[model samples]
Target: MDITVAEALVRCLEQEKVEIVFGYPGGAILPVYDALNHTSIRHILVRHEQGAAHAADGYARVTGKVGVCMATSGPGATNLVTGIANAYMDSIPMIIITGQVATSQVGTDAFQEVDITGITLPITKHNFLVKDPAKLPVIVKKAFLIAATGRPGPVLIDLPKDIAQARIKFKYPKTVELTGYKPTYRGHPSMVQQAAGLIMSSERPVIYAGGGVRISNAAPELLQLAETISAPVTHTLMGLGCFPGNHPLFLGMLGLHGTRYANQAVTECDCLIAVGARFDDRVVTKVSGFAPSAKIIHIDIDPAEIGKNVRINLPIVGDVKNVLGAILPLLKKKENGAWVARVQQLKKDYALRYDRGGMLKPQYVLEKLNEFKDDDAIVVTDVGQHQMWAALYMRFKEPRSFLSSGGLGAMGFCLPAAVGAKLGAPHRTVIVVIGDGGIQMTMQELGTAAEQKLPLKIFVLNNQRLGMVRQLQEFYCEKRYFGVDFQFNLDFTALGRLYGMEGYTVETEEQLLEILPRVLTSPEGVIVNCIVDPEENVYPMVLNGSPINEAID
Candidate 1:
């Protein structure tokens, strides 16, 4: 039976089991939008193109599915650039379906026309510009396959308006054959054995795990390896919630703003097993000084990342789950009580403890929040001092519970990400911890949350300044703060009301203790404006050009 290309596209999405699509419609994409209404696939109308992209990214991260998003050509497509780049940087799987100008007008600079595929080429894993209606199913199948396999990333499929309006007999491809594409899943036995030998022999060993552990669902395997060797484990920002935050073997996070003891443990360990983690600069401040005494064993699916940043003593190129599975049998359970005792001593000495200072301290705010929330609650944050504070204070026990822009560190990510997270996991309590400066960047998304009637607990850390940049200026720029302070004092709570949300501001601990619980447990969509101290800063920070172990508290 012949069908419209738009119908073919929608049917293919149903075949892929796509239940939801976040998008914004435009003049060029009206045909696809019309077909969309005939289908059962729920479409979320977003306030801006960026929100759609970010929401999709968040959904993908939580569900481990290929998140789908759509936009019209030209400016609409360009607006998705930031969110797409964010997903690419973090290795999140996403499929972006964009509406394009007619195929004949590809190079004519027609109204609302831009070569979106060309624009996103550098960031996307792969992209397709479809001119033929018959090839729609195949392109979409290929796009999803490429997006979810190997090292995951976003893929784009641009459909021209004329192509969408064309009619053709559609058949979804059973499977795709690509000679150039293959992901290595089974790690070499010899390499796994070598890694096992290092783990069993080393007196003081540490496991440095990253986001890949969560991606491959290798948390159980990671725990098995750590427990078998009686070794302590530290995580990267993206690696949070992979291991229990309160686990005895946990060493908190490592690198800049990382726990002092975790960095010390890495510096002093005789062996280091890096599982599914790339040694980014934030983690390894000075390459020469990172894990200098350790014989590093790197396990990752991506071969290019093996030696891109730090030197590797042993490289195992395979899925973390498969590689860890192979190594578990050869590993011996070690009763290294002395090393365990040492780890305990380090943690005890450097525990995160703060004194009552300013009335509206950010740490105190987060610490109290951690106390009030349940273990299963989801906490999302924007990039700032508030994010660092949340990382230091919140206790995460489950994977995908804590969402943030780890690689990209995008400022205005929390609000839209929280929207996606809540929609994706409706049963879980979703709270967005954002800063005042970051809030204004994409505060328009509040309208979306309100319109959707989403019960979002938005905690705005209102310091009235770009807190991180101000702190940087204090240390490096002779305290000459510029373009950081917000003297106008925009009312966040009032703005939330305009967006049909319940709003409140807490300026003191008394107000917080009385009001925070109400906001956290509130059934309605609400925004809590927390008036925090402007002078606050994230501590245990490494000075520029310093070793990871050398940090200034």
Candidate 2:
């Protein structure tokens, strides 16, 4: 049976078992949207193309699938850039479909035409411009395969208007074959043995885990490795929920805005086993001083990242889970009692602290939120002080429970992401913690949530300032305090009401305590506008050029 290329595209999505697609319609993409009307795959209509991309990103993170998002040409396709970059930076698997101008109009700059594939080249794992209608199914198959494979990232497919309208006999490819793109899954036995020997020999060792742990589903293996060797574990921001936050051996997040103790442990450890983590500048503070005493062993699927930032004493290029599994058995159990005692002492001495007696603080709100929410609740945050506070305060016991814009640090991520997360994991509670500035960036997404009737518990930490940048100014610019403060802050609770959701504003601990329980247990969506102190800043911050351990509160 011959079908329009647009129909064939839908069939390809069905073949891939795609349950939901987040998108916005426009003229260039009309045929695909029309064909989608006949499918069982749920299509979430977002107000903006960026929201659609972020929604798909959130869905992918929570569900461990290739999230799909679509948009039309020109501004519509360009608007998806930030979200695509966010997914690329975090290693999230996503398929971005964009509609281009007709094939004949290529290079003519026809109405609503743009070179989306060219613009997204550096940010995507792979991308295709579909000029041939017969190749749409194969392109989609390859896109999915590339996006969801080892060291996952976003892949794009740009369908010209004419290509979508063209007729083709539908045949979704069952397998994909792409040359020069094989991913290594198994570590060499000799390298694994050497890593085990190093682990067995070192008296003070620390496991530095990152987002790859979650991507590779290596948390169980990581936990076993840490326990068997009795090594303290410190995580990168993207790695928060990969290990149980409450575990005794868990040193909280390490590096900028990291726990002082986690940073200190890394500084003093004799061996640093970096699993699936790139040594980003934020995490490595001053590379010369970072893990100065440790011999570094890096395990990652991407070989380019092994020695790209920090010098690695040993590099094991393979899947995190596979590498850790191989290294686990070659090691003997250790009782590094003195090192364990030292780490425990550090944890106690440098525990996160904030003033609780003063006016509302973001940290206090997050601590209380942690106490009130279910252990399995999914917490998604936009970047800023509120994001750091959430990372420091929340306790996550499972992978994918904590989602944030880690690498890109994109603002305006929380609301739309929460919408996608709730849709992806409807059975689980989804919460959004974002700052006033970030919420305003994508607050329009509230309409999408309302239409979907998603019961998302949103908390806007209303600081009335770009809090993170304001803190930076205080530290580096003699407190000039330029351009960061919001002279007129929106009433978030009132804004929620406009979207047909209940809303509340809390300015004090008493008010917060009063409102938290009710809002948390509510069956309908609700937003709590938390008026946090503007002067409060995320602490244990590493000063520029200083080692991670030498942080100031």
Top candidate by lDDT: 2
Which TM-score value belongs to model 2? 0.99
lDDT of 1 by residue, 1-553 (tens): 8989988999999999988898999977888899999688989888999999998988888888888999999988999999999998889999999999998888999999999999999989899999778889999899889999888999999999999999999999999887898989889888888888888889999999999998998999999999999999999988988889889999988999898999989998989999999999999999999999999999999999999999999999999999999999998899678888898899998787666676599998898998898788899999989998888888788889889898889988888888888888888899889999988988888878887788888889999999999999998999999999998878988988888778999999999899878887878777889998888878889888999999877
Give residue 80's error in model 2 in angstroms. 0.4
Regions of model 2 farther than 4 Å from truth: none
Determine the C-alpha RMSD for candidate 2 after optimal superposition of all C-alphas.
0.8
Clashes of each: 0, 0
* Candidate 2 lDDT over residue span 414-468, tens digit each: 8888889999999899989999999999988999999999988999999899999
- TM-scores of the candidates are 0.98, 0.99
